[model samples]
Target: MLRLGNPRRRIGIGLMAMTFVLSIFAGRLIQLQGLDSKVYAAKAAEQRVQEERLPARRGSITDVKGHELALTLEAREIFVDPSEIPDDRRDQVATILAKELNATKQTILAKLADRTSRYQQIAAAADPAAAQRIMAHDLKGVGSKHRYRRDYPGGDLAGTLLGFVGTDGTGLAGLESTYDRLLAGRDGKQIIETGRQGQRIPMTHSTLLAPIEGRDVRLTIDRDVQWAAQKVIADQVEATGSRTGSVIVMDVRTGQVVAMANAPELDLGNWMAAAGADRVNRSVTDVFEPGSTNKVITAAAALESGAVRPETPFTVPDQIRCADQVLKDSHPHPVERLTFSGVVATSSNVGTILATQRIGDEKLHSMLQRFGFGTRPGTGLPGEEAGLLPDWKDWSGSQRCTIAYGQGVSVTALQTASVYQTIANGGVRVTPQVVAGTTGENGAFTASPPAKRTRVISERTAREVSAMLEAAVSEGGTGNLASIDGYRVAGKTGTAMRYDTRCQGYCGYTATFVGFAPADKPRLVVLAVLQDPQEGHYGGEIAAPVFKKVMTFALKSGKIPPTGTRPSPVRIRAGE
Candidate 1:
């Protein structure tokens, strides 16, 4: 209403103000499009293009006959876009996901409430059908992609030996860890342009690199025999109320481990839930005094060194004094004259010490070394221990006497079986192996090279010792229970004092029996051991039965027929 200035001047002032505003807008646009174009463009590209990893297919683990032990199967990875899920329906979406995916509602809700994130993984290795059921609802922001899941078809079968994998697709223990490099192949990747909602951009260039698959690992374990051994040993462990138990079955001819079983075995599918102690493969890892099972080594050494013959007579009494220690038989006995074979058959500690004295300490130590004692079995298993065997020069006064009766020396279950394997294979000690070989990308099956073999004793001495072992399992022998029907069994019993690390001294007894079938012609050797058994402490009472059961199964399954030839009776008593 109040008119003040000239009309032309007022109009010019308004025009200048509008021109300045337009100039500023133009300058800003030029700065964005030309001066800082690369920076802006890069920001935009980063927001649109996403790089994702394409996982490689892990290898399969098979037993000797191509039976699948562990393998990988296709699955789905379920994910959600938290940014796209409606705030009002977040709880409802989380509930639905929890129902279909078997996930906790709280966990799903936590992931869904993260509106700041564009993508959140809901579940990995989800069942493909379950994923499909989830996608059927056509729930916005929810999707699934292809993935792979490790499958243990046998569940706990050979779990300790085969090992398990981790969530990040790496082997965590056992053979899976041992062969990780060969089992875990190279992973690939893909870079694709995406939309604001993470949808693939149509007609946009994408880069992809395919993954390389891993090789298949073939093992020397026989599936059927392994199952039998595991069942038998597990039953025995339960019956004996022992702390733990182990069994090893090896082919004397090839030194191939047919079955290595442990009680309270690890469950491959649920390895994360198992106790640490149960996860160990005790057959190769745990060491214990060989007890009477070690007597055969003494007999072999004495015979090999020409210090004694199988029939050489010794006056064995209830006890004998050596190195300030009174070595005695397991039980009190009257003084009696018996052959060396008779002493072994009776498991007489006094008789064994007398025989060891003849060969002296050095020869016995050398023979133990040659028989794979004091050294690792070299079976390619993880956590293998070289059983303790003190040098003869380092042996204490009592150690020399106790060692002759299997008290001072420590050996693993596998090593004990290998010792018998040497005797069964005509004194040729072959290195034991679990892995047969690997199947490469070309699919050609290549066998592992022959196991290293060494001559521990002469064939004649081995035969003589074999005869003595046979007598040890006969009617008057300590391991008579180990004799199988229709198969002449040859084995020895061990009930050595257990050295407990927890108690820091001897705490309990280790019951063990190692032997082979078809005594006249040894084919397969089986060793069974029980640690800290509460039911009975005697090897013949607790361990011999386990040996019989496992050996019977192995013999039948292997299609090994007993030799028709009769076992020639070896004199176990002086008069007889």
Candidate 2:
């Protein structure tokens, strides 16, 4: 207490006080200038220099004529910085976003509750109107980014073939799914200065790398033909009260599918509302007993194996008994003798079984495989099923007979069309090609090589089978309704019983017709398949007429000239 009075002690106390104050200041200066400098500089840089990835635009899907089937357009995606949102207005902001973006209030609230997060996705690919509404409000913390939105301008035109894109910009079906790799491009990046609210600072120096667009996919589909097919099939399906229907149009020479249409189309814009089954590409995915339409394969096998000739005679009965099942005609009639050509022309189940019996199961299966049954058509469409064709070694007596007439075995519309394409192409089975190739960034097109081809039968056999098919479309044949004036048309009619899970057996019928026009030198193969029709369910009654209209339009549009002469008739002599 008396130290203040002493000179020496007072001098020492002054020095000590000076040293303590200097030490405190020096430690704070070091902390501010050295230890925490990098941390502070980084924080400053975040507000001045922002790095972000630039999204790449997805590719377009086009028809052979460069018509857009699917594409991408600039659309707004809503985002947010929860930290920038004022606490007092949080509920108000959430309510506004929920109404404009069609999002849940709870979702927006949860996002707003995270005060630490600087970024959050509020909505993806919102329409322009919604973006406009949000901008009009000019609310704080709400932001938008322009991103590519997958679009199908033709509505459901080629929905099954063009497929769809998901919210994350990935292909999910059809050709889109098949060639997704080439369609999704690489993203880029940019480093720029941003304000606290995440807006770009004006006139700030920045680095940017531009995004590359995906290659455009050019399909072999003819938009006109596709539209016609889709319209006709949808109409017929609704008229006949069928559950579902599909149509396929293909170029005979190239095995390129011109159109693949399914009824009650799956609209790409509203895909989420469509039933999963409706979105299926029935041309390749769904299998049905081909009914009498499969007779062409049997006829080809018989002719190729030299088991029978067009003039070979068969005494067809109304009902024929196999091992355990009785095979009967669609309508009952007395026994009548018909030529091998007449057997096919009439779509006679008994006569076809008799013809196939001569060919044997092994020869028949070989012919079916050669015709591209029991395998994918190699069209590049994903999820394609190799329609159920069991081996000859597993065939029972009834199975053999039923298979001969297109029952007990299943096939897709694609396989059925390929069979005719094989015959039309002179027995060489060519793989179906969906995409022609890709369009380069320079706007140059690279053509894809034609798919592999295999000779399924000799020219002589193909010609013979084709002639039999011609007679099948003749005046009195079952496919008579399929004929078009000024053109020589050849095709088969099919009406097969459908299996019912409710009863665990055959119940309803699936009608089908597959035909080509200008039969002498065919150019187009068109097929119409109808499932479970309530009225006039026979192939000839329902499917053939539709085939005629669609094929007529296709032939006209394709500029195919009519042949001057109709095909000569094949006469069947009565049994002696």
Candidate 3:
């Protein structure tokens, strides 16, 4: 009886199974169409919609006269969607991409073979033309996306000051790093439709959020002057075989840095091409015992205190013993008397010590503070050193005597220039500035105010010191080599043996020259420093010529009229 009923029962069971399947399908349709419509809609939107990042263009950086220094160019990033590639063409696609992207064949194959990953970057920062070529092949999985690249049009000119950006589109050094927030713009996002192959669907519904462009930056550097200074310093460093060198040119009126050049120099476009030392802005960062260049501060202190006059004479000595230390000139001479101006012109350490003795420690320290020593120059650049000026209490007998002639105390090239600038700008101490202004995304520009000046000495004292500085360029003076053909130059040459901490004695020498032009109407202050010269160790021999070349070009570039009376070029005696 069971065998006879089997066929009919099986047919009934099959029909019941078909009904159950149809009922379940209808319930799913109701849920999708009504009960879970909102949730499904959201899921559909998420699948169909693609959010793309829109990066804003970074701002351009220009010189004071609007010459472009750093700018951005449109570029592209090439990538591959591994899942989109057909299995049959995978090897061919991987080979072509590997060669073009400079990637290993194994790397490309591994990326393409990764079924778990939907997208993979093949090459970041590909040039537009190269990216176009790659996209023209129209490989199944390969694609390109728009991006930005930083360009330095000026190349190595002002490279140390302008700095460069990293691969991640972030600033790495210099002004770029200092003003990163202002230069980097906000990134926007947009929702766009995508195809099944992971490519953006053309002309699909898109919700765009516009990105805000970054603000522009204008610097106080003059490209021409910067180039000239860099050239001169580089040439000088090579010629002298100097271990390192730096040059700085600053505007006397506004305290704006006109040119800052260091050798070795770096090319911002290829930062890794140069050594780490070449990337250093020694003018602002490195400090050394300035030698006789610091006599300006001692002279200023004496002048401000009314303790000495330009004509005031001091009992000069060939050697003076302070504590257990014996201080002598570069060469020993008999005890001689000299005027205050003569003291600076000859760079006599004894005379400076005698003058400082009259001004005392407190007055001299106050004057040094006003000259911007022992503190950061406030240049707003990273790694700006405040320089080393030990407190007055830290000054012992030997320290005080040595500091008078620019020994013991340390200062950067910028601080030395500022000291001359203070005298040049009628004894007003102004804060040095590099940035001229910043332009906002809204097309409004905010300019930096004129440097704040505080009167540190009487106008009469500045003029008096100016006259004494002029005397230093006269016949038989240490810095006579700094005099240019058409300009009356006032400056001092400094040669101090660098104290080797490891050796606990003087090792090499740092040669320096600090001066300003057109002694009657000072316009520019230039400071040049050469660290550890091999050929010639004297500041007058190693550093003064560089200053002459730079100051001559800078004065001419500034359109500073010649003084009409040319001082005779002092013939420097070898080993004098």
The TM-scores of all predictions, comma-separated, are 0.96, 0.90, 0.90
lDDT of 1 by residue, 1-576 (tens): 997899899899999999999999999999999999999999999999899899999999999999999999989999998888888888888888899888899999999888899789999899999998999988899989888999999999999999999987899889999999899888889999998767899999999999998889999999999999899989998998999999999999889999999998999889999999888888999999999999999999999999899889998898988878777788987898899999888999999999999999999999999999899999778899998999999999888889988888888999999999999989999899898999878878778899999999999888888888888888889998998888888899999999999999999899999999887788899999999999989999999999999999999998999887667777776876
Per-residue lDDT of 69-107 in model 3, one digit per residue for the tens? 999899888888888888998898888777676778898
The per-model lDDT (C-alpha) reads 0.91, 0.88, 0.85
Task: Please give the lDDT score for candidate 2.
Answer: 0.88
Error of 1 at 312 (Å): 0.9
Could you tell me how far off, in angstroms, the CA of residue 223 lies in candidate 1 after the best superposition? 1.0
Residue pairs with colliding backbones in model 3 are 375-386, 376-386
lDDT of 3: 0.85
What TM-score does candidate 1 get on C-alpha atoms? 0.96
Residues 290-310, candidate 2, lDDT per residue (tens digit)? 999998999988988888999
> In model 1, where do residues sit more than 4 Å from their true spots?
1-27
Sort all candidates by lDDT, best to worst.
1, 2, 3
Model 3, residue 571: what's the lDDT? 23
